[model samples]
Target: MTRYKMEEVLPLLEERVRRYTHNESTSVTYEKARQLMESLLYCLEEGENGNGMDIMAGEGDVKTAFTLGLARKKEKIKLAEELFEKIRKDFHSYHNHGYEETVMKGMPAFFLRYDIEFDGKNHLLTLDYPLFLEIEELTGIDLIYAYLKAARIEQDFLKHFPTLSVEEILRGFNGKYEEAYFNISEIVLYKALGCIMVKRPAGGLFMTEEDIMMLSKQLQERSKEELESKLQDALLSLDKELHLQSEVSEYFMTGLPKIVSNFLYYKKIKKVFLLFPKRKQKMKLQQKFQDGRVMEDEALRILIEKMQACESLEDRLYMVKENVRSLRDLKEILKECFWGDEFIQVFSLLSQEEVMVLKKEMKGRIAFGKGCIYKYLIKI
Candidate 1:
């Protein structure tokens, strides 16, 4: 016999049932259908052998019970079909709106397909055991009971696989499986919303430019602290209502990236300030650029010239370094006007090639010392 306990097997069964019933067409008689589904779910929850048959009955008797249970389930399904048809007819005019469409069409079909794919596959395969365990704990049911019960019939199979090893389980059986299912459905919903927002009239999901501008202005008027407070309150409300984590890191790492990328375009920050450096050490080279010791006129001109020539933020930073290296080489001739440490610090952040370019520019500037600084810098 497999060492796998009833607690271990229960969650798989519950998840299967959850998926199966997710988008099930609930009727005007949904209460009746829900009860029937619950009873089936309850059987899985209480354990298939909850009637004390596992202990009291022989192996042959257990098989008989299993066979009978399956028969009884089929009859219940037939009754459910009848009731579903009635409900469908009654609610014939009821269109599946945003929420209903997601639950009914997306989740239900996905579950049915999942169960079918999983039926003959080995039970031990799992993508993430922890996530599966979490789902099991939440639902309070076994997910693999049906397959396990079937596996029990073959003594050799049971002997060979006495226990369901977490590693042996298919990864698809875990909650990650459900996450993928939900993610796909969410993508579809987002696309639909996008269509409404872009193609539909202002009265529909889309609003006029004036309305958008007004909303933007209103939001801008709010103090940063007030906005942050409101955002926190909104997240807390969502956490309570949805029973999910509301942390920024979790949101950014998981579903948020996909959602945000779909709707908004973001600019990359070229210059990054290390707010939290691991170590703080002052370099000796920084002393040279301190004050009015070096001529600011030529240095300023070189910096501005390079900045203007570069098309992008990255290019501009590159030019800063090129100017620095050239100045470093002419250290002998321009000892009185040696490049300062402040300039070096800024240059260090740039690429090596940019440093080379700066070196060349500095050499030219020093050689032609009489050039108009403001005009040359502005032209660059």
Candidate 2:
């Protein structure tokens, strides 16, 4: 039982990633094996209960041994080793202070909130709670949601701002356009041959005389219908940038780093929960998380009905067991349903019986194998 260094693990990880990237198999086996090895690395560093050797022997022996064999005798081992070194460097570098606070080894708040300033001016718009929650779950980045929430709040405030006349806006640009029209919220200056032209937001957008002049000249030749179409596209783009997770942070780039941080955050969270292993505490945290992301009641009811509509009891049981976390949790949900008290009681009783049946099925399988029997006997 020897402790392995990061260098020792690099060859194994590289080989797995090489096969995965080359599409050696349609399955995700190599990727999963790589993740397993990475988890062992984390355990080795953290030494939660004991050294990596102990944890690998007690919990991860089978998978680690199998993946080590897969890494053996790889033809592209040199290339894989180079790739692994790059990955290792990038993973370490991405842990900036903000990333460390929000996603890496930190349990970020489910909701991100912050104030926003546009063109050095603050807007009164605020993100609605439901939309904030939606964004939170969508990006899976709590800090990004804060910025989006601020922008949305400002957007709502902008709805009340007086719309400047197109002529007045164009006057500063020194453009000759008499019959120009643009709503402040849905601003677009022109269209060309049924093609809508969009204005770029530069130097604080709508705040500059130059922007107005440029927009005025663009709209001077367009028919009202074409102008209207372009305006629609511009407004949609603005709304999307504000409401969706287009870009939340100026401090970080938008792609791979954010993705990698999010992946690492969840892995860290799982490791933390596993270390503590307190069922009640875990349940409470999970409940809070699920409340923000869970399906609506009507949707849940429809799903339950669909499961009930399955042809056989076994099908229904399997579906419920797979989808639902526990019998007790399902029972509580049924109690809150508007369907009826009788339905709730019946569901509770039937679900408990099904759970027992499923347990007995597992026990029956255990009876057929000595290794399974040994495991079960130790559990009791």
State, as a TM-score between 0 and 1, how close model 2 is to the true structure: 0.16
Candidate 1: tens digits of C-alpha lDDT, residues 1-380: 32235565445444444555574643324554344444444433233444533633333332344344444444443443344334333221112132234323433343344321113122222312121011232221133332122212221111211011111121112323223322222222222232222332211112223433444344345454554443344334433433443332244234444433333221122111111011111221233332214335677566665455544432443343334433443232223232222222233343444445445565446443443322222212
Report lDDT per candidate: 0.32, 0.33
TM-score of each: 0.20, 0.16
- Candidate 2's residue-wise lDDT over 158-188, tens digit each? 3222122222222322232222221211121
Lowest lDDT sum, 10 consecutive residues, model 1, at: 271-280
Which candidate tops lDDT?
2
CA displacement after TM-score superposition, residue 343 of candidate 2 (Å): 22
Worst 10 residues of 2 by lDDT: 274-283
